[model samples]
Target: MPKNSIKQDENINNISNKDLLIRLFSYLKPYKLRVFLILILLIYVMLCGLLNPYLMKIAIDKYISSKNLQGLILLAIAMFILNFLSMIASKTSIQMLSKVTNKILLKIRQQLYEHIQKLSFSFFDNRPVGKILARVIGDVNSLQELFSTSLTSFIPEILTLICVTFIMFYMNFVLALMAIIVIPFLSITLFSIETISRKRWQNYRRKRSNLNAYTHEDFSGIKIIQGFSEEEKTSRSFLVLTKDMMDSFVKAVRLNDSFWPIVTLSSGVGTILVFFYGISLLKSNRITIGTMVAFIAYISMFWRPIINISNFYNTLITNFAAGERIFEILDIKPDITTIKNDIMPKITGTVEFKDLTFSYNNDATILNKLNFKIYPGETVALVGPTGSGKTTIVNLISRFYDPTKGSVLIDNINIKYVNLESLRSQMGIMLQDTFLFSSTIMENIRYGKLDATDEEVIAASKSANAHAFIMNLENSYNTEVNERGSRLSVGQRQLISFARALLANPRILILDEATSNIDTHTEKLVQSGIQKLLTGRTSFVIAHRLSTIRNADRIMVIDKGNIAESGTHKELMKLKGLYYDLFMSQYKFLD
Candidate 1:
């Protein structure tokens, strides 16, 4: 089970039904003009429904009793016209509700997506992509019925109930009391059921999210499962999650399904009680037979809305479960924000860390209160053992994360005060694992600079040494990259990413294991091009392969959250320290 859940974070008992309803209905305010029109149409339809029972009463008391066939015909015609108009209004109201519900859902989804985009990387580090997707896709979809029935079913049925109840009391108050005698008991039973049902349904939603998250994770790592011959292991894991989801679903639905039966039983009891009481009133000549007949008709009309309202209450609870999750996501404030940030102007390529310190989720410090400076046009290389804060350094420079204690400065201006977009826009970063979108090679390269000309793209590709292979393809630059560039080799994909960064023409470039995926032959092919691209730019190259950074102006060997060694390749080799040990181990088997 996932550690995250609503109950764990919030005591839902604190959120009253009124507050939830108020918040949910606030979404309706945007389309209030249309909603008002819909309500008017629904009221018309409800009034038509309320009239039918009285018309039958009139037929019994006046028109049919006199054997006045023409009067009866006129009454029937009037009832038919009323029913026809009601049907048209009902249909029109439903159509309007659909459009309104869909628009509100779209607005909600857009807000969720935009908020998620603004959140800092640390927020994502603790959550799975699949869990996030479940809220965005499945949880958001659950609110559709709440919106649809709010206008189409809930409001109309409620109004009909009110009108029908009032008419029954007006016709005969004593019998009206007798007819609804079972209601208090029914309401008490429903209140108990709803409280328990809400919690169960919330559990089911959580289980379903867990199941979805596991399925997505399994599929994403299908290759690893197959490579290790762990298909049966994965299958067992999937079955466990599926069974958990099924159990919770069955429990929740079983409780929810009992609602209708309970409602039917209560309605049956109410009708029987009314039938007996109406007989007493008729026998005593307290009410006319037509009025007795209309009372029974009104009883059915009244109880039917109660049944519908009970069902709507079930829908409301289910939607509340979904709404809680959606609101939880929307309620999150982005940890890192561009608020009150100053836009960074173009600068010389000098970068410095000033007493910088950071930790992931506030774990053990990855970077201590260290300080360093790289001058304009310097080609610096960072070499370290695994988990030596190499990536964190570049990430800080790009403003992906704020330092815990101090700041990173570009040209002596603290990046903490700089707008993230403006800060990152000046740097080119190529990560170890490259990702390509579904588009043609040309478009993927042009992504670096949306308005770059074809000539510029071609020039960048040539400088990155990607032009040769791209041109050899059947469709050349027009060839599709496919999903994550699966159709292309690792070297080809990395080369395309190289071209993308090159096209950006950034003043400060950081290549973090950019050539790790490429074979030695492919690495050699791009070595000269890499040097050319690095020329006159402040560059940070993080590589495990010592040979790649042999010509760097300086190499910093990071160790235990601090720089252990810093010098040219020869200087580090002469020191015979940690850098010397790492350099020897990498090439010991080569020669």
Candidate 2:
């Protein structure tokens, strides 16, 4: 099994039936009026059904037995009319219920999506995108059964069961006991099946999630897989996951399928007991032939609801795992509040790190108690070997992660005290790996400034040197780049991302190898526009190329979780320290 699957299984905390039922039922609170109407309709249908058997009893004893043909015909007509109305009410009620349940499903999915959005980066960091997607899309859909069955079937089944029980006992106590003789045993059997089946279904859901995670990761990295010729290896892994899910599904379904048979068998036995004893009652003249016949009808009614309730119970048990997974995500409190807080600071972009200390997963320290300051409008270039805290430095400035111990100040005000929106809104930080939504070029560019005009988008694109290429496309600005801008060239994607950040026009701009993908000609073309965009705004640029960082106001060489050296390019080259070593290394990579 995948390590993620193991972790997923470990994270499954047991949710009690009471808590699960209460939470699931709470979704119907907003649609209670509709539920009430459904109840009235179902109750009317039930009364019509109950009246059926009693009418037969009256027809046999009071009308047919007395040879009163007129009364019998009238009674037959009344029964037909009752059944017709019941049919109409039942159809209308089911239609109304279908609408109600679908709306409830939409409500639940919306809440899940909103909750997932609020969660901090740390939540995403630990989980796979496929796993998260499974919860949001697959797990949320699994709950449709719970919503549909609970409202349309479960409640009415219980009510019907109760009403049938009362009518049975009232007609004749002994015959009623005979009618329900097998119920206690039937209950025990179904309970046992449910107890065993619940765990199996839970296992199946986890396996399904595991399969989803693997499939997502596999497809997402398909380019790499094909590049490395690892298709067969991935296929074998997929087969294993499929077999695991298949085995679990079969086990759960087999147990659930057994439930109906046992209920049907029990119903058969109860009817046989009723008939055998009712014959003895008839012989003793303790019950009428009409009453005996009615008892048979009531016996079928009694078992009908039992069968319905058992089916609903099976559905509940199967989908209970899905419910738990959903609530588990909803119950999570975001590590950081995403909502706009009370403190909103006007930023001039002076960044300071005071005794900064950080670690990821409480493991190795990525940044040791480091301290530094960059003046407003200063262009600080961060250069370092891999894992030397280059990206971590900018991530801290953006307040993406709270420091393990220390404070980051924007304009001398602790950024932790400032509202997240207020802080991030004033800062534009673009990662080396650029991402674009499945949208048009214009829309993607407009994301940074929601109300940006078409001309402004073109201006920003021109500033990034992306205008030339975009104008050559089929739809120009309206052309959809598809997911993550997969259709665009690497440099084109980065350029559009650059345009987006540029459109934001932040007071502070952090470019993490922003021009890495652009060809030399494109980079040279945009350098002047880039400088203008950087002018009068505090900027942090993390790049490897000497040409990119040589022009920076101050170059900070980061290594071993701290600043190894800091100075202008020439001054650092004169120092003959870590900065000069880095510069010489890049300088040696000549054409």
Candidate 3:
């Protein structure tokens, strides 16, 4: 298995729910005033709710039993007014809290995205694109309901429970005592269920992330599956992944669903206890009939809030699990970080690798102790057998991955000591797999230098020999290249990439099999363009096409992470080393 795959199997640190909640709520600090207003509205609504039961008691005792029709009518009018006010307050609170929730979500998503961008390449190397997408989009969205309810339901329910308990005790202590007897039992049951449910919910989320990763991988590779006639096999694999996700979801839901029933059972027991005890008090004339009725209403109020609070706790646990996953990424310190006082200076393209050695995860080393230097304005060709560390060398030069030992230097300064943006800006790299965004051809070429004008983009395209085909398109340079440039041919995509690189006008250039996929005709066109582009830049070329490198100032044959041969092509051919053998293998027919 690949080193990255093994790294993915390692578990992330388990963060406590308390810590997760603290971090999650930190996003709400900026919207405190909106939250404060919502809190006031909720308290007002709770007050309105409390009034209805007390008013009912007054109407029953002073008006209904006494046949005071006028008093009863006035009380009914007051009740209606209170209900209307409550509705308005509730609606206003919802509107305000919704705005706060959306803003918090926006901030969280933005922070996650920006943090992901700052992370080093190794972070991405060990994780799938889809899994990262799941955390960014899916996991972050799971907190939306939690944020919305925190103010609307959670706060109001807690206040109602406290107010109801106090009012119950104020009316009659004995009945209040009886009503709450079942609460301790309910609390214990919920605590046990929550402990079990938390684990189940975490498993469900992991399964969900895995399924998303698998689905994305399949879609991205659907063409390969179809070409190989393995659609049924792929579908079977997808079904298995989805089934695992469903199983985990069902288990979590089952545990969560059990919670409501327990709450309901406890609610019923509390009401029964309060009813029987209140009847005894009424028989003794210690409490009036209206008071007895009010006690029952308060009991219902008390139990309903208990149920809401319980549900809120369950929601909190689930969202907390998601917050843990999100914070896991946020907690990762970027492997590559710029020095606090790093300098930003223009590079002259003199590149050096001093005793450089590298390995992925301390696994077998890809490059050994290697030392080499390339002068400014030199074009060097690196030829080797497969897995000879050709691409690794270029990656090191670009600082995509730092050397595990030793250093890479440019212009007599360590690349690590230089600001990454300044260092990378002066370097341009093109790979075999050309990636273009779903944008117009002009925008794609302009990506190399964001501020380049239209005329400059056109000049870059013409220099790359991409202008002719781009003009033939339906909208010329304005034509949209679909996702990953799928709308364009492989050769066309490579030429566009070349145009982008040329537009950057970097002091250093690295091309790793850039033209290996193009046909002879396209290669000829790109070859001329590349020659012009490499005129004054230090360039590294890795190619299987020997003809392209014959004119290079130096040709180095790398073998087992060491330079086996180095000299111009003519000098290496006369020496008949690895380079000569590779050249003969590809173009003996020319001789």
What are the per-residue Cα lDDT tens digits for candidate 3 across 1-591?
A: 122231132245678878777888888899888899999999999998888889999998999999999989988998998899889999999899888999999999999999999888788887888788889999999999888877777888999999999999999998999999998999999999989998888888888888788788888888899999999998887788788889988999998999889999988988888888778888889999999888888988998888888878989877777888889888888877765537657777798999999987677898999999999999999989988888889988988888999999898888888788888888888876799999999999999999999999999999888899999999999999988998999889988998999999999998988787778887888788899999998999999788989899998888988899999989999999888889898887766
Off by over 4 Å in 2: 1-10, 338-340
Per-prediction CA RMSD (Å): 2.4, 2.0, 1.9
Model 2, residue 158: C-alpha shift (Å): 1.5
On residues 1-591, what C-alpha lDDT tens digit does candidate 2 reach at each position? 112442254267779999999998898899899999998998899889888889999999999999999999999998999899999999999899889888988998999999988777777887777777888899888888777777667788788888888998999888788878888899899888888998998899888888888899899899999999999999999999899999999999999999988999999998988889889989999999999888899898899888888888998999999999899889988876634365656678788999999987687999999999999889999998989999999988887788899988887887776678777888776789899999999999999899999999999999988999999999999999998898999999999999999999999998999999989999999898889999999999999876887889999999999998998999988999888887777778763
TM-score of each: 0.95, 0.96, 0.97
Instruction: Please list the residue runs of candidate 1 whose C-alpha ends up more than 4 Å from where it truly belongs after superposition.
Output: 1-16
Query: Where does candidate 3 stray beyond 4 Å?
Result: 1-10, 589-591
lDDT of 3 at 208: 81
Clashes of each: 0, 0, 0
Q: Residues 1-591, candidate 1, lDDT per residue (tens digit)?
A: 113531122222335678778877898898989999999999998898889879999998998888989999999999999999999998998899899999999988888899889988776766677778988999889999988877777888988888888888898888888878889999999999999998887888777777777788788787799999999987887788788879988999899998999899989888888888888878889898888878888898998889888888999877788888777777777777765599889968999998888887778999998799999999999999899999999888887788888888789898777788887888888988798999999999998888999999999999888898999999999999888898899889999999999999899999989888778887887888899989988999999988899999999999988999999999999999999999998889677
Q: Candidate 1 vs candidate 3: which has greater lDDT?
A: 3
